[model samples]
Target: MIMFEDLFQSTTSVSLLVVLVLLVLQFFYSSFSSKQQREPPGPKPFPLLGNLFQLDLKRLDICLLNLSKTHGSVFTIYLGPKKVVVLAGYKTVKQALVSHAEEFGERDITPLFHDINKGNGILFTNGDRWKEMRRFALSTLRDFGMGKSLTEERIIEECHHLIKSFEQNEGKAFNNSQTLTYAASNIISGIMFGRRFEYTDPVFQAMVERDRELIHLMGSASAQIYNMLPWLGPFIKNWKTMMKNIKENNEELKCIIADLKESLNPEMCRCFIDAFLMHKLKLEESEIKDSQYHEENLVNSVMNLFAAGTDTTANTLQWSLLYMAKYPHVQDQVQEELIRVIGSRQVRVEDRKYLPYTDAAIHEAQRFANIVPVISSHRMSQDVIFQGYFIKKGTSVFVLLSSVLYDESEWESPHTFNPSHFLDKEGRFIRRDAFLPFSAGRRVCLGESLARMELFLFFTSLLQRFRFTAPPGVTEDELDLTPVPGLIFSPPPHELCAVSRH
Candidate 1:
């Protein structure tokens, strides 16, 4: 009887020890899982629809900005099944893009981006291919006088053509969108093909028009829907149109590349294409395996450069003119600065420093226009604990550039077209850290220097010669400040009177 009792006691002891060990493991597991699921706070998502009903995709920038107010800086929103984490305000955006750049560096190749380039271009691709292509493009652009005097001279010459085009308007109300796009596209064309197209060239006009259409279509409501639910691609009208534009543009680029190849000179690198071809030949001679310098990369890179180099710069210039027409007093001040500082001599790139208010006005236009509201979405490369929130690898991140540009903490008058935002009390042009229109870190716009130079030279020169005003029948108040929703916020289709200051 004693022996039986001892065996029962031993069994009881073993059972209790097993229970205690299980409790310890449960405690650790529960703690770790809680940490893992601690994602950024967001509105409760529906089972399948997600936060779709809650958003205004038309003005996505404004919609997301409003959501940030309720959800705080880092938050989540789902479009259908895709969960996107947005970083808002200047502080949060700067920190994520600049401080933890590598962590949030990879391009999130959405269904649309993948369809467009097939993971081939500098803009949408990642890994070793992206790095090599970007480095090559930057170096080749520098060789072709991207930010140097050679480019300035090219812009100056182009400025003359632009001025003559404006002269054709004869101070009457006219839509200058096509002309401006042509001029901007010509600058990039010169670098890409070693020649510029006349504004009247059918090929040039078609190319620019198609690109503008593609950009607009990419931001359409239908396109957004297609992005979320890609199986709807065949049914989506915008998607069909975009694919057609892409195919046509791709063919045109291939033909241009073929012509350039016909007149091959290994020693004389005429332009970007020549430089690329020469590099490829050298690699082949050296028997380098799997070089990234191939025809597909060349075609896609040129297309990327051509579209980006043209649209944003042209759209910003368009906005500047519209703003001048809308606010005559600001226009007067800019003109006064130009007259005082330049006195009708060709406004050189060197003249930027001497004209502070003019420079501030230009800067303000960019900030206020907010051309690219949200940057192309970035993909998180690794699991990161950011701002005390756990973000998993491969999550799509949208850096709301609109939030940063219009952050109340960063700008004294965040909602207004105030050049004083970029000016100090002494009336000097002061650089604002929050001015991030070109974006920051790895995927920042590669053509920033060239774009800046273009803006300064084109703007000052045009303002020096022309006084933009509302159309004769339209009052300044009638001129709408509402932007046409697109991949870029472009000034709505409106006519402006370019009264000659000469």
Candidate 2:
């Protein structure tokens, strides 16, 4: 009986000890939670999940806007264990990106970008490498006819092909995305390889498909997960697969670069690649620092140009057509302006000067679409104080460009699709400081001039030849201006008929 009593007592003692240890662990966890939960006044976060539960990935922009209203312009949210500071509203974003430009000059690569860019490409690189690439690219683009006659001529030829494709559509309801894609891709092709691909070319189609797939992958939950937990990539296997696909695309680009190099006549440099090769040769001859002009950098730069230039311009064109279909009055005004300027003949870049109203409408379309919803990530090179906050060195920052473009303070009708935003009292085109579709600062888009030219010429030419309208039962209000959720915001799929105005 005494032994039984002792055993019971011992078991009771062990149970008490276990409970005590659990209580201590709870206390520590509570302390850690207090530290993490102190993140700048946001909506209540779940214990382990943070605010991820509150977010709807499909309607990300709307969700962010709502959160911003509640949390104010600058607030912190957690994606897994990392603290992400979201800057909403134009004032806050401007202060971070423009007012404190030097402090926020670097880019945060994230695990996925790091894997894809390999820390070598200009978009991903920092410090000396970025400076070197930026200088080279600017010079190369200038030499290759950016804002020059040669570039404008190439654009004119591409615009003619696009017009032909539209004519072939026979005034039927069709998705103009493919035609726009063909035209935009060809522009990049001309710049990169000194050649243009036919719309029906299989190889060109493959490249576009690959690019689209990669872009689509960027916004996937898998991408976010991989970025937060990079160590889990090999174990997950799917991340590896995605990486492999990206590598294959890079390899394909390299092969094209190689072929171009083999066929190049050093005496007559025609394209961007030729110019780069010449510059590289000169560097080697002078025995200067040769890290900047490597073959990989050249190929990646060409790839960057294609990737950045193609989809953005194509997407904007698609949106412009949709808007025209939705608002016939606006379309008529644009067409009238074009007719007044060019009179149903081939339009040139020079003709934009005469078509002020048409130009304003084009600018307004870009403003309404606001394709690049968020600015690219930038990082602080050193510890800097921004608006009383001690932003640490190496901290990643982003400017919510959508906030600026759609700022109520800046635009009279921030939400509406109004061309009056770009027109003065005299009905002449006027530029606005807030109209930063290509973004601003040192890392502003390299293809800005080319993009503007394409948008103007293509839009004017299309309006001159056709009047876009939605098919039966489709209302103007039914047109979806809501952008697809991604790193780059694209309009959701829709179709419109291009009735012949010629």
Candidate 3:
């Protein structure tokens, strides 16, 4: 009893010491920050907590929107010791992400993710390396038919498999998360490793679960707090487990790399991995020492490609499915359009031009889903004064994509999920400048083209085949549109009955 009591006392003392150290560091940080040029206006943050306590970590979108009301479109907020300039709304987010693309193009590695990613990969890297990797990835994916018939054929193939899975459910209520993710992951799997996994493959199953956990864990309130107060990491909930998950995911990617390494042929590259390995070999022959095409980069790039391609595309489709179920009228309109345009024939990407309503509905779904509200942090490469505020070089910037999606000044019914947001009076599909779901400029989403293709093909094919409705006794009114909190704004856990419309 005495030993246990002593251990508890020791723990308490060490925790207090950590707090003291953080407080002192924060004090120095604030003092140093204050002495810099005039920063953007924002609410006063606390000694060490900063604006963390005031913000709702889960629904940070709402919190940021409210703060923008008081702090103007462009304002600063401290996420722990980190100072971030948030660009809110259409005009503000556009100005920062598009107009000042070069200055606001670099990504900042947060403490929570820094250990996991280690400043490698296309998503996290910056400067010339980022440009090189980004260029290669774009070209490779394009060559594989990112927005063309090759990719379209892959989507059509996956849709058949996915539709079969839903059919096996026999119109009963079923949670589609696992199957949906598998289908999405397989698309990237084919692109990355040259083959898709069986839906029942245990390895693929584990990969999906790992990706979901890592994304949710990183975006959790606990992770955010840990990034600010690294001293309190051990005490944070599931910190060790999250780290384990990250390591396991990386290991799995490494294994995939190892398997590919055995049979790589430079002239006949199978997929992204083979292409990268070929590049590395050429670099070696040229004596290009310390090239970014090494194993660390290869593995990280693969992970980034898989994660981004799977989650964003899958989650957006999931939400769109829910919206269709919730608004049967919209779903009916889509089916009618599909049936009218291409009766009994498989829906093609080319059909999208003729199906204006269906296209608008999909766009509105992307806008309303707002999968990523606060985007990954971006850094200013060089100091610049803009909008009467002085932001220093390397100052982290956060773009409120949610603000842009639901900007009152832009959308007529910003808060509601209305397809007219993407349709003009003549009923033609119109692209809004404020609709920056994939964001804008150099740091825009790497898989934007592919994601758009998947969303359209997967969505159209499904609705053309199935009549989505709420489960058993559930009514449309009973359906919840509020998302489950995490890195992506996923729809709540609820089953939907995919009644066959065929």
Candidate 4:
């Protein structure tokens, strides 16, 4: 038998130990629950699956817009463990991308970007490396006549070639997509290699097809899957096939670079590759860090220029033609302006100033088409307190450029195709703050000037020589403005007739 005092002490100790364990468990449970609740107010997430069920994975843009209605401009969505905060509307996107530019300056280097870019290319690199590559690209482009007389000459020559090709169709309706692609690709190829490939060249065709495939993969369900699950992407059957195509394209690009290296002449260096190679040699001599000037960066940068420069300009031109065909009155006005300014002679880039109405029409086409609806994905550089919400480092953000361009408050007739949006009461071409077809901030399209020149020169030249019309049985209403899913948005398949005005 135990004493009564000893028995009471034992009971007290036992009760205290039990209470402490219960308190500790409660604290742990609360901490975990708080973490689970930490995500910004969003649709309820299921265990492991999260909000995947709520999302329409195929129609990403539509799904995002729908979510924005319920969650406001800035809201969080989950792709498994990843939390992406999408910024919608003009004000929210512009504030994050422009006002707080540096804080949200990093690119979300996904699995595919990592594979193709290797983090060395300007588009993918961050911090010091990005600055260095950007500076180099700018300097090189300037040297290569990006905004100079030489570039104008190249564009004029390409415009003539394009006209000839259209004339070959002899008013017979043909898909202008391929012809435009060839012309645009040649412009970048001329800049990169100092030579242009014939549209019929097997190698060139292969490269173009590969580029098209890669771009198609971007923003596709397969691409999202790859980004969400990098480790499993290679093993996934469909992703594996897409990746193989990408790898083949990369290999082909490398082979082209190899050929360029073999053909390099120290005495008479030509083109971007030659200039880059020469620069590399100088850097080697000076013992400078050659990270940005690597052969891989060169190939990737050239590929980037080719992909970006070609597809975007081509698609925009195609859309312009479509609109011109649909609105003959607008086309007639543009043609009159072209005739008044430049006459039957080849259209000059300088004529843009005198052709205000024509310029306005071009602007309208871009606005109406609205390619690149969302700006490229950007990641936060560090923790930022934005609109009372703490956006942690590495959070994915987007600038909804399309929303801004088509914003009802900013645009008079946001839904309509109106050239008056860019025209003043005096009938002069006026630039709008909301007009950002080439994007803005540090990551603005590097080839903006080149693209602008091409669009103006090509459009004016074509208008001066021909009248684009709908193919015989196709009505204006039949023209589709629906865009195919890709990194660079493009119109669905359509064809038009180019009647000679000569």
Least accurate 10 contiguous residues by lDDT in model 4: 1-10
Identify the runs in model 2 with alpha carbons over 4 angstroms from their true place: 1-48, 234-241
Q: Which stretches of candidate 4 lie over 4 Å from their true place?
A: 1-41, 235-238
Evaluated with TM-score, which candidate comes out highest? 3
Clashing pairs in 2: 106-379
Worst 10 residues of 2 by lDDT: 1-10
Better of 2 and 4 by lDDT: 4
Worst 10 residues of 1 by lDDT: 1-10
Ordering by TM-score? 3, 1, 4, 2
* Candidate 1 off by > 4 Å: 1-35
| Clash count per candidate | 0, 1, 0, 0
Compute each candidate's TM-score over C-alphas.
0.93, 0.89, 0.94, 0.89
lDDT of 4 by residue, 1-502 (tens): 1123543467666875675566456545533654743444566655444567888665666677777789888887766545677777777777877888888778888777887677766777788877877788788887888888888899899888899999999998999998898888888888888888888898888888777777767767767766765644645565665667667767887887788889889998678888888888888888986456788778767777778778888889999998999898899899988887778887777777888999999998988888887654788888788876777788777666777778777899998889999999999999988887777677778999988888888888888888999999998888787888667778888889999986
* Ranked by lDDT, top first: 1, 3, 4, 2
Per-residue lDDT, model 4, residue 217, is 72
Report the C-alpha lDDT of model 2 over 1-502, residue by residue, as the tens digit: 0123443467666875675566456545643664643434556655445567887754556677777788887765655544556677777876666776777767787888788777675777788877887788778778778887888888889888988888887988888888898899898789888899999998888888677667666766666766765655765455666677777778888888888789888889888888888888888999887458888788777777788888889988989898888878898888877777679687887877888888888998898888877653666777765554555576556566787788888899999889999989999889988888887766778789988988887788788878898876788888777778666777788888888875
Q: What's the lDDT for candidate 4? A: 0.79
Runs of candidate 3 with Cα error greater than 4 angstroms are: 1-37
RMSD of each candidate?
Answer: 12.1, 8.2, 2.7, 10.7
